[model samples]
Target: MSTPTLPCPGCPGRRNHGQYLCRTCWRSLPADTRGRLTRRDKRAVLRLQQLQQALAARTPLQIIRVSP
Candidate 1:
């Protein structure tokens, strides 16, 4: 079975259902932000919110940051 995909939140590309951005857009994000987003701890939801807010504000991918 293949994973379902949807339009990426960060770009016009498609991404896996559970992913936040397409591969290219995800890679464009800073390493620290990537690490924080991947950590499924108590702050995970907040981190996702931060990302969404940044995207909504049209922040550049390379400088986007989420809470640690």
Candidate 2:
């Protein structure tokens, strides 16, 4: 049996073992800045980078909620 693979959060690709991102996504991540980063901080940085890319590719929309 082969190891179970998961879909990449950034792209439609399989994530590698023990990693949240696939090879392509991993390579696409922005370079780290000059500072100390905890594990949680690192994850947050990566997540934000992914979100920036995803948001940049689409048009923005405004939504309004109405209540009675």
Candidate 3:
């Protein structure tokens, strides 16, 4: 029978510990520092795309609302 494998990738040059890691470093990152995209960033990109789409459709609307 095969043994139950853990998440710890015990590979050479790998860092981290625990079954979810290797055998060196650990996952000690902030909840928000995990390259999480901000809502404002998403909104800005979406707004830009909407603008481009409207321009392509030749029906652009001028609407700007400041968010607190």
Candidate number achieving the greatest lDDT relative to the actual structure:
1
What is the per-residue lDDT of model 3 for residues 1-68, given as tens digits with 9 covering 90 to 100? 33434543322344332223232312332224212212357455554454345435644122221121
lDDT of 2 by residue, 4-49 (tens): 3997665667876666556665555443421111145536566545
Candidates sorted by TM-score, best first = 1, 2, 3
Q: What is the TM-score of each predicted model, taking all chains together?
A: 0.92, 0.43, 0.28
Question: What local lDDT score does residue 68 receive in model 1, on the 0 to 100 scale?
Answer: 94
If both were scored by TM-score, which would come out higher, candidate 1 or candidate 2?
A: 1
Candidate 1 on 1-68: residue-level lDDT in tens?
45647989898888887788888999999999999999999999999999999999999999999999
Stretches of candidate 3 above 4 Å error? 1-40, 60-68
Candidate 2: which pairs clash? none
lDDT of 3 at 61: 26
Please estimate how well model 2 matches the true structure, expressed as its whole-model Cα lDDT.
0.46
